[model samples]
Target: MPVQKMDVFDVIVSGAGPAGATTALFLARAGKKVLLLDKEKFPRDKICADNKTWKCLDIVKELGLWKQFQKLPKAEIYGVLVASPNGSEMYTPLHEKDIAERGHWYNVKRIHFDNLLAQAAKKEKNITFKEKCAVVKPIYAVHSKTHISGVTYHDAKGKTHDAWARVVVGADGSQSPIAKAVGHSPVVKGRYATNTRAYFENVKGPMDRCELYYLKGICPGYFWIFPVDKKTCNVGIGMRPEDFERQKKSLEQILRETIALPQFKGRFKKAKQVTAFKEWGLSVLGKRRPCAGNGWVLVGDAGTFAMTFSGEGVGPSMRTGKIAAQGIVRALNENDVSARNLKKHYEDALWKILNPEVKGFRWLEFLLLNERLFDFVIAKSAKNKELIEISSRMQHDYTLSKKLVHPKTALKMLLS
Candidate 1:
């Protein structure tokens, strides 16, 4: 179908999740004419574990939303409890200070969390938000199929329109249309993980921290129970695609079996399932392809920046959005929207900041995938207070985490 060109924008961000919303928010705050588009309306449900790390909290604070985030109903996460295949558990506090002093992490439903960000972006004078707008394809420049000039999208009423932009930001997530249109493989099959999540109410023994269980059935992946409130928890499981296919059982079946395990059976005996199972894909950071190209850049899941080990993308996604916005601003100022320019200034710099952590997590995922190694680490951490502390700190501090994947530490861990 022919697309009708509409008003031009300084930047058009596709998708309104954390990445897109953050990108639009930053750009609009800088007085850029930004258009934010999303297929769904605000407060729509998003499939995720719904836990925010310290890094994610920092971005929220950076956006000046920390006070408002705190005002919302959320569960304060203090630490993590990890259970090994052998049922041995290790408890690690997230930080030294209490939630009051340090302002601990949180577990919030994405429906509410995303809406908060969308609302923030909506308030920006330079940001024009269009919900129920689905981006169908990238509009390329005349005589150049490789360079994106804008996007063609369909509104709720099925009206097709084209909006031109100097640079288009692809925050559309794992199944990003922009990434597809640009001929970039958004997710490498081997590096991708499949995840399924559901909400449960009246869950017993709900703790103030998140819990992860590495069972025999799922080695490379783990099951998580993240409490969103006193009565509700986000329960989910994640596994490599190969592992998932090998199991032959559906994710729902795996979830059921996981909850029925000896470790979790009692806690879930009285729990009531509040939502149906929903699934999504995650592309770990290390496996991501080039995020920047002519007249466009991809952020968040669209750029495949989720962590390898934990499949956490919120923090990394938001960070990428901020970086992309900065890069877009620079590119706009210089009037250089070429792929080479954006790639050199934005994509390269993004990987520089994120590569080390991605490599570290990739190593961690490799080690944790081994059942014996995972069991040993969990068992050892259970008895070793220092190791537990280190493990806890690694969740928030990438520099500290690098030590875990070091040759010396790996040898020590294996030998000991």
Candidate 2:
């Protein structure tokens, strides 16, 4: 997978999503020559819940896209509306302090959201942003196979080209070629989720609250109708591939049947699907993957950063991209791209920031595994404002997410 023709940069980023775009922008701003490549052209359609939490907006502000993002066509989300199998429910609002300070959460379609960042990246003098360039594999230094030197990619013309860099980044998605080159592939069963989504217009739902449903059939796997605006909603469902096997239905079938359920049918009676149902796989393990290595680091899905319980990745991806930039900048300045420095500056530092919360959610994911427990959890949460507040913060910054698995919290859910 080596290439004879070569171009060089200070950093080569493999994907141009939030993670890669953020990394490229930060690196470029730091005066690093960045080669940012993406498999698709700009304004491409990406299947996502398309919601960006307030925490995600913090990074958007940092990237200098806030003012522009504010001008985009989107929804300002206030909270989540969740229902359990028995129809017991809870609505967890974003912390008021944050809502006052940052205007709370948003639902921006990924097409507009990603293009905003990518367009910004393209404008940076230090960044060479290439669209429609698909990476083939990472190029390792001839002397050391462990040290990634750059990448080989297939251009839009199907011609191969090489781009060398002091450090290469695998910001590519879960099925990353670079990830596989580093031996991070072979998707682990039960650590994965199969999901399906589609856009619909004329859906009747609360625009300010994301609607989530946990039903007997879907059980731990869940369904959502996250409104993008007044007239449209992003409808989707997720299931553990292992669990989905027992259902004996396709992801599309599950989504269709879920929508056809009596309760949902009333809401969508006049709503029309604007897009075809699409399926995607996610790396949902809360445990950290090997993200940093000699001359390279992974971010976003490539690093398996999608949340186990919620399947949310945008916030984590941008957060990791921001940190990955810091690591790359430090590495470039010190002229050390070894595994040790990247780990210290990137991996270790990242997990230190995310581990507790992530570990906590991993523990809490158990609640979503069963219909009975989910019903109880939602029921208790609706009755207890304190519970709603804790659940709200848990999605962002509750450090002791694991504690909820024990103590009076568990007891409260059991006995309430």
Candidate 3:
């Protein structure tokens, strides 16, 4: 672990996923030299259903990547279908349109989507791409007792290289080496909350619809089947670690029982596992705290910006990266890299944009955990046209506002 010879960059991004790629894109576009490093090569794959909502689309457009984004094979997910443990069901469609205003969201394979974004990042003149480079640790200065100056990494050939940057972005994700090297402790405990996901292919269904089955007693979590393509889908269940402990069943067992439900048994008969089962402990959420110190910041799952209820992070992660890039660029322009100054970017921009949504999602998570309320919503949702319409809209703010009905509204929904 001798410090390797260093090459300098304005920004050294540790992860080449959506967040890191987008951050590099923004930074490079601003004329800052960026070195983007990733442990995986291009066309790398990741777990999770690959879905992007308008929250992410806006950033794609801002980065002038909308057109390319459109070229990918995308299935328009009309809305989500939710079923209660008791068998009652509801469908919610997403609202928003592209050119013709046809659909509000798109689903594509992450392998393709992530590589596409990274390719876009490569097109930037100021970015130097390094794939298969595993970051070892953050290069820190003893004097400041703050700020990560660079990173030391090992390449596929066992060659070690060090790269220095004015600022470091730990977009390296949940198991971030840079985050750990910088003295950031893992807040997510494996014993408390953990998630398991399994990916399958050749599932029978309309590619445009994703389904969520809410099981009673499994509060704050749901079973999901997200279609990635005509032939593939992400079938998984995420619940409290305590639930798994109590039941003492494997993740696959829960998932198999879920697929055996009458609604899915026939449709998923042809499905096959394309990837091995995967499990990861989610990072503990940092509600309003600044994710950056003096010279480094963490984005994406590394910062646990995933929605507590939905477990959706792709859009928010990319958005956070863009906002982080903006902050870093501004700090560089002002010749200050202090955490206090850089904190303004997250405080004024990133958190403000996502805080309400996170709070709303947290509330929904709690409500879903309450079996009485879960049952009430499912039963009422089937008959409540207003609830159905609002649910279909896919706007978190609107949905949360309307869904938190008062007694009068509740009466109206249930009676009507």
Please list the C-alpha lDDT of all candidates, in the order they appear.
0.85, 0.85, 0.77
- Candidate 2 yields a Cα-based lDDT of 0.85
lDDT tens per residue, model 3, 345-379? 65467877776676666556555767777677778
lDDT of 1 by residue, 1-416 (tens): 99864779999999999999999998888779999999999989999898888667878988999878887777988888888877888888876753445577889888888999999999999999999999999999999978898999999999999999999999999899998887767568678788899999977874698988877778678899999987899999998878888889998899999899877899999899999999887767665477899999999989888877778888889999998998889889889989998998789889888767876776676667677777777787677666777787776665566665567766766666
**lDDT for predicted candidate 3 compared with the true structure:** 0.77
Model 3: per-residue Cα lDDT at residue 101: 54
TM-score leader:
2
lDDT of 3 at 319: 85
Q: What is the lDDT of residue 223 in candidate 3?
A: 81
The residue ranges of model 1 lying beyond 4 angstroms of the native Cα positions read 1-5, 97-102, 405-416
Under the 3 Å rule for N, CA and C atoms, how many clashes does model 2 have? 0
State the local distance difference test value for candidate 1: 0.85
Alpha-carbon deviation at 18 in model 1, angstroms: 0.4
Which pairs of residues clash in candidate 2, taking residues 3 or more apart in a chain or in different chains? none
Question: What digit string (tens of lDDT, one per residue) describes model 2 on residues 1-416?
Answer: 98566698999999999889998999999999999999999988888899898657999998878899988889878888878889898888888776777777889899999999999999999999999999999988998889999899999999989889999999989988998889886376567878899999988768887888877767677899998876888999987777788889888998999899998899899999999999998877566678999999999889888767777888889988999999889988999999999999999989888877766776667767656766777787788766777877765665656555566787876676
Worst 10 residues of 1 by lDDT: 94-103
Q: Alpha carbon lDDT of residue 331, candidate 3?
A: 91
